[model samples]
Target: MAQKRSIFEEVGTNEVSKPAPQGGLIEKGRKGARKGIRAWLVVIFALVMTMIAVGGLTRLTDSGLSITEWKPVTGAVPPMNEAAWVAEFEKYQQIPEYVLQNEGMSLSEFKSIYWWEWGHRQLGRVIGLVWALGYAGFALARKVPTGWHKRLLFIGVLGGLQGAIGWWMVSSGLVGERLDVASYRLATHLGLAFVILGFIAWYVFLLGRSEAELLQARRNKDAKLFSMSTGMLHFAFLQILLGALVAGIDAGRGYTDWPLMGGQVLPPDPFYIEPLWRNFFENPALVQFIHRVAGYLLFAFGVVTWLKGRKSANKATAGAFNLMGALLFFQVVLGIVTVLHGAPLALGLAHQLGAVALFVAISRARFLSQFPKSQSVREGL
Candidate 1:
């Protein structure tokens, strides 16, 4: 029989050809995985924002003290039985807030606050799980880029530290004669949450850039934008700390009017009981007034930044600029409404959410401003 022609020869080809499309498919797969990772990071950031908002609610509703103990593991599982509920309630009764502020509160009344605290804790658990699973998958699968690994790892560490700080803040209340957490500690805890958020926003901004473009941008526009952005971020953070102080002192309860406190430009004798130094943190009127002043300053800064961004040709900068302006306006409105409503649950939560939105917007603007015009936008005009 004639020699059987090989398949390559039969097909009129001199050499066996490797499949070219396979390489393309692999490249495409890699790209897809990268996009997925970035998208997931955005999701994680959103969850963190949610956690912060809920935490604010936990504070505003006076529910943070509802759970006297910080049993991180056991706290995950809420009361399953009637006896368990009573045990939880009994523990709360020992706290000064329950004894003094809620003397006549019933089990059902207690459960109402309990659920808010429970939900807040549960959200934290979910965030932890999501971060762990997503991070592990990214690491093992080699999906995250080499540059982001260190920074992302840092963020993860911060996330863990935030949890510890949260517990530390709670622990303060359990020991002191005071029924509530200290304003300073509360500020630190909430401030760290914003820090985590700012880091994520910065990382996302970096990921959005191509390596070559980022390198060029680093030499040109990064410094100015970075400085301004950093300033805004710091200012925003301080504003949050002030707000936390206001909440810690229950200052919102005292000042229900806007543009003035109790029908006056400033409330009378804001620091009547204590040394002048203590007024900033201890006096309800002073604390609230300080938060209000911070709001005005934040609004002014946001507007100025947005205007500067408008003068630039970069779309990212412009978007960030507009975002900050819009968020600031809404936040200011929300703040006034919250005060007018006696800080109702819904409006208070809205105010907190507005603050987070403003932070994200300001962060993005800062990130974009740091990039060169060409890197932020396609070159050619």
Candidate 2:
């Protein structure tokens, strides 16, 4: 015989379950929102890289000063008709670069350079818009990871600052007898661009892994290797600024010979120009010589750093360093070719692209040294 249940006892009702674990994460590997944010960052990274290459081309083509004005809001709309084109051309003609260097250039020619500068500026606007929209969407939806809002916001701030710096650079060449922007200002603008790129890259790398994974991996970071790569990163940045100086003064195109300038280890009258200090920025021979020496030293230091990176226990970290070594060598070769060809438009752009690649590689190596990816037996022997 079966026992009868009480009327108050509901069928299939169970006793109280134990409380869930407290003071612990409920989700470890689920970070879809963060991953989406990283994907958006990758898009911005590609845009900024394209902007860099475009800016290089604009400089190589002698088109940087065509706009003669910076209209952050209204400049988005380029010349729409012939009268508008003439108005823009007349504005360019008033600048020293046109009056002294490009005098008698037709409206058509002016239009060509104008488009380049306009395109460059337009790209910047596009990047800013993309960032603003993406950040707003993520923030409003509460998708951004904790502590990331400021970092993301900082990029936008730097980007706006870069726009201001760009105008300041152009303004340097617009007046007086100067035909180009000051080398130091140019270097600042470029250096800031690289800094922004580095930050985005590092953030992207960090976001690639789950927060839990990063916390776990931080325990095994190789301090020495990280330091070495950090040094390499700074050295590489210095080299980039030097390269900008060389380009600013057309030094690369002047000295076509390797291991020598004008058939001597040092060019004649290294300080033939006035002020003595002008030779550092204005003297083609000295600037080229300094750039070459820096390149050599950078290569040597890179080899030492790569060797140290090889000793890292993590395969991914070692592989990143290896790529960095290969890129450094390739960039050196591209640089030599660029010099031999007297910095032709194509080769000059190629060399600049090479520098971009090397910078990203070194950054990646440095990042891996700090937050290495662990490999499992399933991944390799």
Candidate 3:
């Protein structure tokens, strides 16, 4: 009964809109756009940085083995009363550190060192809790970017392993005649900390831009600068591990001289320690000497990398590298001062902090080399 349509009329001109084809390209823009995650990571980054500084202080103060136990949960609630504190001190007394080094320490003195170690562990616990809460909140709210699930997961795993490794390091000194944690184990623990820090940094960089922007920037990536910076990064990390070794043995307090070790170009009895290889780890003079030589080499390489960075057309990228160069110089000066002062608690902590800043600076420059942001100047209008 409806009027017949005209012969020229279009058929079904208004097509039905099917629900967004069920994924694929339709989901690309909607996925992985959580910018807040980057800020959260930055918070965690700052906390970890502070943790490292506190750890340096703990080592310098000789408070590392105060707890003598790894009660991860129960340890968080410190002794609330004098009796409890005495109980804690009794436990510490059983450890070799207290027996050998702190045999005559009073309960008050024991409490001082105990607090330092306790705070260090408490900081670790806080960091882990922060990561757990943030990751959970983000995942539950569906805010995490695509491809980041595993990356975040890996960090959590590393943190757990780090706790275990920390206990392992502590356990090393609890038995035997050792006065402190094994130098090798300390280096391992510190190296993993840096590794975790580096990953967080790289993640923050990636989250700084949209996926599309990163893809576009990749097209103009400076291969040469990136390559050199990568080398610089590896070299710097190696230097960090070496520095940890020096710290483990209190090597910086060994030779207060700059150009020489107690007036000799090489440290006296550099290989006097037994087992040959043990000298590198246990000998303060040798460890400090190796650290100095490694620093020189690292600085030279940084110079070469900085030169390459200067050639970048992106102003920001070039500036990043220039800053790195300045930090390298500053860090060197700090290290020299730290050594001259016999690695006093304050100066040692400052020097360690300088290393942290320099490492972060180089990392930033390396990132810019890979994803340089172009600067546009208007032509003569």
Maximum-lDDT candidate: 2
lDDT of 1 by residue, 279-316 (tens): 88788888898899888998887777667776666665
Candidate 1 ranges with C-alpha deviation above 4 Å? 1-33, 216-225, 372-381
Pairs that collide in candidate 2 are none
Per-candidate TM vs. native?
A: 0.86, 0.93, 0.91
Whole-model Cα lDDT per candidate? 0.80, 0.90, 0.88
- Stretches of candidate 3 off by over 4 Å are 1-33, 377-381
- lDDT, candidate 3, at 102: 83
Clashes of each: 0, 0, 0
lDDT, candidate 3, at 258: 86
Q: What would the per-residue lDDT of candidate 2 be over residues 129-221, giving only the tens digit for each residue?
A: 999999999989888877788999999999999999999998999999999988888889889999999999999998998777888788888
Q: 1-381, model 3: which lDDT tens digit per residue?
A: 987888888887556856665544634754554578888889989988888888888888989999888999998999999999999889889988888888989999998998899999999999999999999999998887778899989888988898899899888988989999998898998888888888888889888877777878989899999999999899999999999999998889879998889999998999998899999899999999999999999999999888888767788898999999999989888888889889888888988888888888889998999998856763211
Output the better candidate (1/3) by lDDT: 3
Model 2 reaches what TM-score against the true structure?
0.93
lDDT of 3: 0.88
